[model samples]
Target: MTKKVLAAVKTDVETIEIREFDYPTVKPESGILRIEASGVGGSDPELYRKAGHVPVIMGHENVGTIEEVGEVAAKRWGVKSGDRVALHEYLPCWNCEWCMKGDFRLCMEVDFFNVKDRLNTDRFGMSTANKPPHLWGGYAQYMHLPLNTVMHKIPQDMPATHATLAVPFGNGVQWACLDGGAGPGKTVLVWGPGQQGLGCVLAAKAAGSYTVILAGMTRDQSRLDLSLRLGADYAINVETQDLEAEVMRITKGRGVDVVVDTTGDPKGEIVKQSIALAAKGAYLSLNGLEQQVPIGEIKKRYLTVRAPRGRSYAAVELALRYIGSGRYPIDQVCSHTFGLAQVHDAILATAGRGVQGAIHVCVEPWK
Candidate 1:
C-alpha cells in the first residue's frame, strides 16, 4: 500500500475537512515538502468566507524542510534533503514576459486572480486538489513542489514559526522600502495594523525612516499599540482622533514622504487620505485592492504610486535575514499557533473572530 499524507482540506464555505492523499511521487524537477509552519495569511478570512473554492488546501505562506527532492530540483535549487526553506506562493512559467522582467509574481500562468485551472498550480493553495497528487498546499503534512515553485533557503537557527513570516515581511520590504522609498530622513505612514501593515512598519523603521506612523481604527488600538512597541514612532486611532491633523502636525504640515495602505479598504477612503497626506513628490503604495482611487488627485499631488502584489526574490532573502536578526519583538506579532486539525480555528483567529489580540496566526501541520 502507498503511504498517505493527511491534509486539512477546505471542502466548503468556512469548512475544513481532514482528508488523506497519496504521498506525491518526486520526479525529476519536482520535490516534496514536509510542512513545518504554515502561516495563516490575513487574506484567509475572506477566502474562507467565499464559496466555490472548496476541495483546495488553503495555506499558502509555507515554511518547511525538504522531505524529498529530485536530482534535477536539488541541483537547480541548490538544496538537498533536510534543508529548511520558505516558499513564495507563485509558480511562474519562466518563458513569460513577467517572469523575464523579474516580476514573476504577475505571471499569467500562475495568476490566481484571473486564470482558472487546477492543474496550473496558479498561486499554490488556490488550485483544486481533487485531481491526482493532491499535496499542493501548505495546510497538508506534505506539499508537492513542482519545477516552477519558488523556494528560498531559510536560516537553520530560525524557528519554523518565525520563518513563516518571511513572505509578509518580504512584502513589507518590497512595498514600503523598495517601492515607496522609505528610508533615512523620510516620514512614512502605514494604515492598517494587520500582519502586512505591521510588516511595513517594521520595514520603514528598520530602513531608518525619520518617523513611522501606523494608523488604524479605535477597535484596532491594541494592534496599533503593538505597532509602537514593534518600532513604529506613532500609532493613530483614526476613529478617536483626527488623522489629517495628526499627520500634518507630525510632518509639520509638509505631509509624509511615503504612504502605504494595507487596509484593503473597499470604499477607497484610505486611498483618498493617502493622497491627501502625501508630501509633494511622495511615494504611495496602495496595497489595498480598492479600485475607486482618485487618479486625478494622485497626479495633482505628484505622487508616485506603486501597486505591488507580492515580494521580489531579493526582498524575500533580505526579509529572512531580518527575521533572524533578533531585532524586533517578532514573537509578539506571531501570537497564535494551531495544529492541523485546528485550521478552522486558526483562520478565525487570523480573521480576529476567534482569538483576542491575534496578530500573526500559524498552523503547525504536524501538531
Candidate 2:
C-alpha cells in the first residue's frame, strides 16, 4: 500500500485540521524530507489568524533529514539520503540577478505577498495543498523539496529543537547587525522580549554592541528577565515605567545608537517612540506593518530607517555555527514543545492566548 503523509492544515481563522495526502513522486532534481522539528515562527500567530486564504500547511521553520533525494538533486545540494538539514523557505529562480548576488530575499519569484493569486504560490509554508504533491509545509510527516529549495547541512548530533532555532537567529543577525548597523561602541535598544527580540539581543551583543537594552510590558517580566540571562545588558518595563525616560537614562541621555522593534504592532506608537529615542545618527529597523510615523523626526535626527524581514544566506550560516558552538545556553530558549496532534495548542501558547510564558515553541512530529 502506498503511504500517506499527515499534515496540520490551517483551515480557518485560528484553526488547524489534520489532513492526509499521497506521498509525492521523487522526480529528478527534487527530494523528500522526513521532518523532525518545525519551530513556530513569530509570524505564525498572525498568519494563523488571517482569513480568506487557501488551506496551506503552515509551519515554515523546518529542520529534517533527507529521506530521499534524486541523483541530480543530491549532487546539486551536496546532500545525500539520511543527512540532516535545515530547509529555507525561499524557492528562488537561480538565474535572477538577486539570486546571483546571493540575496534570495529580494528574488521576485518567491515574493508571495505581492504576487497576484498569491494563494497558489510555491513558497514553502504558504503553498496550498489544493493540488498534487501537497507536502509543501513543515507541519507534516514529510515535505517535498524542489530543486530551487535552499538548504544548509546540520551536524549529525545536534538536537533537532536547538538546530531549529537557526532561522530566527538568522533574522536577528540580519536585522540587528547587517541592516540596523549595530556594532562596537553602539548602544542598542530592542522592543519586546519574545524569541525574536531575545534573538536580536544575542545578535547585538555578538556584534560587539557596547550595551543591549530589551524593553517589554509589565506583564512580560519573565521574558524580560530571560533577555538579561540571554545577554541583554538591561531589561526595561515599558508599562510600569516611562519608556522614553528609562531609555534615556540607560543611554545617559545620548539616545540609542541602534534601535529595533520586534513587536509587529500596526499602530505607530512604537515607531514614533523609536524615533523619539534615537541618537542623532542612529539606525532603526522595525518589524511592524505600515504605520504613520513622523518622517520629519527621522530626517531631523538623521536616523536611517529600515524595515527588515527574512534571513540572508550568510546570516543563516552564522546562526547555525553559533548554535553548534555551544556558546550560549540556547536550550533555555526552547521553552515549549508539542506533538503533531497538539499543533493548535502550540499555536495558542505562542500567540500568548493560551499557555502562559511560551518563549519558543516547536512541533515534534514523532513526539
TM-score of each: 0.96, 0.97
Q: Candidate 1: misplaced stretches above 4 Å?
A: 116-121, 287-290
Task: Go through the candidates in order and give the C-alpha RMSD of each one to the true structure.
Answer: 1.5, 1.3
Clashes by residue pair, model 1: none
Off by over 4 Å in 2: none
Deviation of model 1 at 184, angstroms = 1.4
Model 1 clashes, total count: 0
> What are the per-residue Cα lDDT tens digits for candidate 1 across 280-329?
89998876554666778877888898776888998888888888999878
Q: Residue 134 in model 1: shift from native, Å? A: 0.8
lDDT digits (tens) for residues 197-304 of candidate 2: 888899899889999999998778888988887779999897788888888888889999998888876566888788889999999887665686677887899988
